[model samples]
Target: MDPTLAIPLLGGLSPAAFMRRHWQKKPCLIRQAIPGVKPPLSRTELFALAERDDVETRLMLQRQGAWELRHGPFTRRQIPALNQPGWTLLIQGLDLQVPAAHALLQQFRFVPEARLDDLMISYASDGGGVGAHLDSYDVFLLQVSGRRRWRVGPVKDATLVPDMPVKLLANFEPTEEWVLEPGDMLYLPPRWGHDGVAEGPDCMTCSIGFRTPTPTEMAREVLQRMIDALEAPEKEPHYRDPAQTATATPGLIPEALQTFTQKAVIAALNDSRSLACALGETLTEPKAIVWFEGGEALAPGQGLRLDMRSKMMYDADHVFINGESFRAAGRDARLMRQLADQRALSAQECAGLSPGARELVEEWALSGWMHGV
Candidate 1:
């Protein structure tokens, strides 16, 4: 997309302008972000998806001024009747299951792929809502069908209601409000409090969320990957104390041992591009529950595309896919980075890969991390 072109998706602002003004800064309500936008799946289709074990689904009900929530692999009969009110069904990772939803996500690629996360769809009945809450990640709430009345604001008080299964705000104050209709959208930055209620039956909203990793969580992943990449010691080295000196305090850790442990960790990090390689692998690692089905080998002259479920990324010296990393440079490095950026390679582009790169591509294809275009 042209960075300077005014986009309806960003409320008539250019992508560059929107990113500068709204992204992670404040909220933006765009009317007709997608003119005449319809729900990607019908009620029945969405319900069927919720029934799948692979899908992450949730059901929330508000009855008699009380809240109840449940995880789902629910059947149609398990869901409330269409005539029912005050209930909502939330299906996470809709982009992984619906091609239309996935295509819709491409529009938001202005954000880096590393930060862009999955799309979630919520189906609600009349008077239904998930309750007043805040998220740690930024989100775009798009009304796909019917109408949702939203009350949103920055919350200073982040306390939650006790004993609630969901993290709901104990006290919420709205500074802005709007009733979003089909094709309307609202963008909320991380930690902004918001609540939406279905104005009528058949309310469906698509939530586009970004990944916000905590520093500690990211450090753990990167460190674990770095450890995995490190070579094993040739022999188990025992702690040594050739000097005839004993610790005055038996419970105290020896200063020599502390220094040795620090040196070992630093040495692992000092290994050739180990930190960079680890970051790439960690970033491209797929969810634990995600699995790929093997496919037939690639044929000659076929184009290629990364599987929707696969995560592919590259650093300066290495390419990473589905938690695996490979050293790459020269023409191969350039071609692989192009594939990572575009998420696909044309037949002509494929022709330019080195023999080894081609073999690697075929390997990924056989493993179902990518497919023939």
Candidate 2:
């Protein structure tokens, strides 16, 4: 997408303008991100998804000012009657399972895929809400059906209600409030306090969230990947200090060993290529619960598109997909990067890849990482 092109989804602001003015800086409420937008799934369909063991679902209700929360694979019988108020059901990762949801989410590609997370749908009955809370990542809340009222503001205190299963702000102070009808959307930055309550039954909201891994969390994953990539030799070198005389205090640490240890760590950390590979692979890693079904291998003339469950990314010298990394260069490297960017490659583009790269892609198709298009 052209950065300077004005988009209706961004409230008439071009992506460039929106990124400069509102992204992570403040909120922007778009009246009709998608005019006449309909929910990707009906209430019945959403409830059925919640019944699947592979789906991540949550049920929340407030009765007499007391809150209750439950994890799901819930039975239809377990769900409250439609007439019942004060209840909400949330289905996570809709884009991974639903074609319509995935297509809807594709519109937000202006944001880099590295930061992009999944789309979650929240269905709420009259007076239902999850309570006010702060999210650590940016979120775009789109009201797809029915009406909901949102109260949003900056977080003054990070305190949560004690003994609550869900994070509920103990004291929510709203400075901006709006009633969102179908097609309305709201954007909130990280740590911005917000709450939404269904105006009536059948209310459905879709949340597009972005991942914001903390430095320590990123370090742990990247470091682990880097360490795992080390190729250990069959024989290991042992530290020796045969020239040293016997010390009166054996407890004293040896300077030579400390220097060796430092050198070893520095050597490990200095592999810039390894570090880049580790980061790319880490970013493209799929969710723990995600798995793909095996399919036929890509034929010579067929184009290819990534499986919805597949995560693909590329760095300067490497391409990463589903937690695995491969060094890529030359013509094949350029085509692989194109696949990562476009999420698909034409038959002509696939034909351009070298023999080794073509074989690798065929393997991906057989493994269900990509499909013939």
Candidate 3:
């Protein structure tokens, strides 16, 4: 995707300009971002998806000043009829399960993959909503079906209503409002208070969320990666202090040992290849609810492509797929990196892959991570 291109999906503003001017800094409301855009799935189709055990779904119902939430592996009959009031069905990670949903998500490729999370679909009845709330992560709310009235603003007090199943804002202050129809989109930065109530029945919205990694979470992930990098004790370096005199309280952690440990941690972090590997692995990890179907191995000389469900990424020296890392080099490395970026390699491109690379692609195909082009 060309960031400088002014596409209809970005409402005539180049993605480059949008990112520099608005992303994470403020909100953007783009009308007809997807001209003539239609819902990828109908109400009946969504209900059918919710019935599958492999799909992750949630049901939320509001009635008489009360909120109810339930997990689902629901059946079609289990869902409330269209005439029902104040009920919602939410399906998470729709992109990982449906090809059309995955294709829809690809439109937002202007954003970095690290921040791009997944597409979540919300199907709601008249006056239905999770309630006024704020999210810690950025979100693009796209109206895919029916109409929804949204009131959004930056809240001063981010307090939640007590004893509520949903984390609803206690004091919502709406500075902007709009009723979004199909193809309309509203982008909200992190912590921006927003509330949406379905104007009528059969309202469906797709939220494209961005992952926001906290500092503590990043530290924990990096530390865990570093620990995993360390080999067995026999192969691992140990602290040495042959010249050190024994202190009276030798049981305490020695200053020399502390210094050594600090230096070791710094050294581990400073290793460019190790850090790159760790970050790549972390980014490519599949969500807990994700899974895949096995497939036949790729034929020799066949082109390669990633499963729409798989997440893959890479840096200069390493490639990451499904939370695993592999060292990459040469023209083959370039080809693999292209695959990560484009999500597929054409027949000609596959033919150009080296024997070793071809073997790897076949293995991925067999594992249901990639397919023959």
Candidate 4:
């Protein structure tokens, strides 16, 4: 997508202008963002997916002024009747499981893939909702079926109802409200309080959410992955106080040992290339629930495309995919980064790979990270 190209998806704002004016700052509603869009999965298909043990799903209801929440692998009987009111089904990570969902997610790639998370579908019966709540991440909610009335605003009081199964705002004050019809979309920045209730039956909304890991959260993840880059601690001497003076405080940690630990950590942190590789690997790591099917190596004439389940990213000197990192340079680096950016490479591009890189890609194909196209 061109940064300067005006698009209906952002209410006629160019990608650059949208990012500058609205992204992470305020709410945006686009009428018919996707004109005449069909639901990614039909009602029956969504229900079937909800029944799969491998898929993450939830059922919620608002009955008699009480909210109910349930996890699924649901039987058809577990679902509310179509004509019923105040019930919703949520299926998480639809992009990880369905091609159509993945395609829908790609439309928002004007935002970097590192921040892009997954598409989640909410299917609701008449009058249904999960209740007013605030989210820590940004989201684009696109109505795909029926209609939903949305009430959204900046959160002033973050108080929640005590001991509830899900977070429900106790003092939600909506400054803006809209009824989103099929093909309509709304964008909300992080921590904005919002609620949506189905206007009628068969309401479905696709949420394209973005991850916003805090500094501490990101540090924890990067440090854990960075451990793989650290030098072997076995090479360091065991703690010894050969010349120690007898002290009454035996429980106290020795200053020498603390110095040794600090030195070891500092040495590890000094390896900038390793640090970059670790960060890339961490960012590209697939979710625990994601699994890929094994396949044979790529054939001679075939192009290559990443599996939907695979996450690929790159930094200055490394290419990372599916939690594994590799050093990349020159022509190999250029093409590998291209593959990560475009999610596929043509036969000509594949032919340009160095013999070592080609063999590595073949191994990835055999492991089902990417497949012959």
TM-score of each: 0.95, 0.96, 0.94, 0.96
lDDT per residue as tens, model 3, 183-260: 999999999999999999889999999989899998788768867885554677677899899689968988888999
Model 3 scores a TM of 0.94
RMSD of 1: 1.8
Alpha carbon deviation, residue 62, candidate 4 (Å): 0.8
Clashing pairs in 1: none
Collision count for each candidate, in order: 0, 0, 0, 0
For candidate 1, give the lDDT of residue 43.
91
Each model's Cα RMSD: 1.8, 1.6, 2.0, 1.7
1 or 2, greater by TM-score: 2
- Scanning candidate 4 in windows of ten residues, the lowest lDDT window is 228-237
Expressed as tens digits, the lDDT of each residue in 276-373 for candidate 4 is: 88788889888888887888889998899988888998888889998889999999999999998889999999999999999999999999899998
Off-target runs (Cα >4 Å) in candidate 3 are: 232-237, 243-251
